[model samples]
Target: MLRTPAAVRDAGRHTAHNYHPLPVVISSAEGAWVTDVDGRRYLDCLAGYSALNFGHRHPTLIATAHAQLDRLTLTSRAFVHDQFADFCRELAALCGKELVLPMNTGAEAVETGIKVARKWGYQVKGVPAGQATIVVADGNFHGRTTTIVSFSTDADARADFGPYTPGFRVVPYGDLAALAEAVDEHTVAVLLEPVQGEQGVVVPPEGYLPGVRQLCDERNVLFIADEIQSGLGRTGATFACEQDGVVPDVYLLGKALGGGIVPVSAVAADAAVLGVLKPGQHGSTFGGNPLACAVATEVVRLLASGEFQRRSTELGERLHSGLRALIGKGLVAVRGRGLWAGLDIDPALMSGREACERLMERGVLAKDTHGSTIRLAPPLVVTPEEIDHAVAQLAAVLAG
Candidate 1:
């Protein structure tokens, strides 16, 4: 007789069903693999939605975190800690911006970006107070906060989360004309992900980012690129905007910034744009604590080395080619950049949830976003052979 796993059953016994997770309960992880409580091993392809981009327990990140724990952890925003300046300066330089405002989570970073843009519009851009509007892509997945979800096109993330926040205009993601038509004198900023992670790792069409940049520049609107899931080496570049030769006025960053040890998020921009915020107007108690700063500073230095970015670009080609070959046999299409990819399974064969379950049974862990789409974003530390193995396991799952 087969018994249901205790970890799977107990996981939902007292918790909310916000996430329909796979039945595997991870007990330990290293590089790109995790071990279940029962001692079974599985290759992790989701990489915590890119939060573990450097892989689990990276040596530098862990060491820094440990040292900080021994020294200091939190001091609040009242009195600055020793590790704060270095983190802010280094991360700002990483984004090539002059200033940075650290926060705690990806959603806080998005909300901070929205607040800064509106304030900048009223104070710097000469827009009328309380009339500023920000444009967002139709299929964006910035975060689940009430204000952030107000503009989301995904019904599941937005439904029942209202009366939603106002002043956001939604436009088709890849349509420049629609975006341009949506913006006007009252527009303050345009927030978007260069690669929409939750919307199945959807990469916009070529020239779409450049067009957005041009539109924002022509209309004097700040361009805020939400790089929470697409930045910090996941997209083969320090920032995904570099892929299109576009530099946004503000960069919303998080996910891997904390090295998967703590939650660290930030908004970066030149002084003129972010200077609109007066002291006490916006701050987080734990935004740049000693521990978060220590860990995140090392993360910035790691990205500065560009090794992870190189690995993502080199390994991504191999991964994508293999996935494309399975199109007619099972997959319908694949789209993404760098180490990120969205695989569309033939719904006739199996839904994404079923495919993921079958893959988990074969020792490969992945995630489903939409009905038939699966997102693959293995950590940059993953090896070429491991990538091949994951692809093979996926193919076998489809075959069955």
Candidate 2:
């Protein structure tokens, strides 16, 4: 019989120690719950770090994946598959962009955006050849890709990953003055996350996103919004930037784009920016594969229906209210929008890791970032009762 300890031990025996996962050995999952190897169940509050925004094994996405699997899966960009056009067209429409460049991961999408921005900078914005620069914000977590990390302020993700990629500038997040100072004639793009998900669901001050948008427009620089962890109905909108009433030049999207069934990512931009790339400029093998497109197409359709976004908005209020009540009890602060949140636990009480362990003991699963900050991003499909239960569990943990 499989047990948590033996399963976890054997699983980690050979794997690299890059991740320090919880000891719970999950064997199966459905919707907002997962069953461990020891027959224990836990509420998945983290939701695959927003990758499972639609919940685990959503019926529509699963059916699409299964159907595509039986019919067809892969075809390199050398030839087009039937599923490609619809996926690209719909996603582009959703993003309000003229074209979509499909990729398989968020990092790949970010890299593609960087390349496109630079190409547009040279060919369109007239930035001299090797001098094009992109400005990023501090406390950003676009991805761990070498170039992405080159401008990252996180030590753990950035340290020793050098000689780092250059031509990137970093500025403090939410400070328009610093960003303006960073931007120059050679600036190709200003890349940012509408909400800093890894930095504890940190929403910028009001007007920050719009300010960035205006800055990019006036300076003739592309605005790339990395929505990998915060888009696709997780933030009570198709995109978190929508809440701020801002639209970036390029949208880097992934995570829920696959509906938690597969890896699918994309960059959506208007023709003038994305069209800078010719045929041979960028391509991915499994990107836009029939299977990915089929599943992601359904994902796009689901988002189009607006059901998940509504759920996130309505349920997010309840979630934030509950967490806010716990501020004096144990939480120091709560910050986020929609169903996504970052809770800063009182360090005097316990570290975020300890709080998470305690929450796990009570049948809730969550993830902690930084030191005392725990982020909550439950699946959008989660019910009101589940939200109350998770909040009550957190309250009980904090009370103790």
Candidate 3:
């Protein structure tokens, strides 16, 4: 096995310095845990920013990928592969949509949705060309693309990345009056995350999603939910919109759709909205590759099975209750749903990053976001015993 220092040195020599990950160098990972290059194991509470909801190296997803690799891999969009249709059909059913356009990354899915909204605005809604406006929420993290970052509320993501794209209107999140004030005749859509994951797992006020849905319906605007971070059974449901019983016009999905293996993402919507795309409008070479499609098919099957979702719901309750018990002790507050949670630490006591570093030394792995908030989203496959153990470790770290 490679030593941690050697591994870090090798990566630093070859790869771009884009991330500031924790010091631990992961060598291998399995359900709910990762082993570092030094052979020390830690529970992966972060789960790759909710990308590994199925846990690391899930057996079913790995088997599907292997089988598909032995048979076929890529054909490009110029031609269709055998796995594409079934993947699309199942995903469309899962999304309750009439069409699905595959992509390889969450950012690509968001870009696709943006394009679709613009086209629909011009062609179907009869808006002037290139003049459509999409309403977005403040403090939302869609992706790191230039256009996506154009409307970001974070200074770090937007500072040097400009000159940014335009044609977006930003409003305060969870404020119905502000959202209503932002929409006008030229508004094409309202794009937002059901829960702001990167914004310290900030959940919108109750009735926010449903209220937005109603407002969109009344205003003839497309409601586009960026579910890439919060979807695919991450929030104890197949989709976070299910929590509010509201369905968006466009469902942007990614992350767990690849089953913690390859990158598989898509935009799902009814024909009336998604049908705006014609030939030569948009495409990706490896968007619907055979291996990704196969893996994603099994992912959809597992997500629809209700096992993972149920586990997230139950374990989340236990985790939240445990953390709530520690609020005055060290934690400032706890906010989230299902297996996803954000623990705000009292700044006077310790910072979120400090708590996470301490937790890492104690055999738990998590990441902090928005300065003082640590987001914990363990894989849905984690057992009850593991949840208790993680809570105990966190509590001990806080006590220390």
TM-score of each: 0.98, 0.99, 0.98
Q: Report lDDT (CA) for all predictions.
A: 0.93, 0.92, 0.92
Off by over 4 Å in 1: 1-4
Tell me, by lDDT, which candidate is best.
1
How does residue 147 of candidate 2 score in lDDT? 90
Model 3: CA > 4 A from native: none
Model 2, span 1-400: residue lDDT tens: 6577788899999999989888898889999999998889999999998889989999888888888899988888889899999999999988888999999999999999999999999999899999999999999999889898888999999999999999999999999999999999999999999999999999999999999999998999989999999899988999999999998889999999988888999999999888889987788888888999999999999999999999999999999998899989999899999999999999998889998999999999999999999999999999999999999999998889
Q: After superposition, how far is residue 134 of candidate 2 from its true place, in Å?
A: 0.5
Indicate the residue-level lDDT of 48 in model 3.
84
Which residues of candidate 2, in runs, are more than 4 Å off?
none
lDDT, residue 50, candidate 2? 89
What is model 3's C-alpha RMSD? Answer: 1.2
On lDDT, who's better, 2 or 3? 2
Worst 10 residues of 1 by lDDT: 1-10
Question: What does candidate 1's lDDT look like per residue over 111-135, in tens digits?
Answer: 9999999999999889998999999
Evaluation by lDDT, superior candidate among 1 and 3 = 1
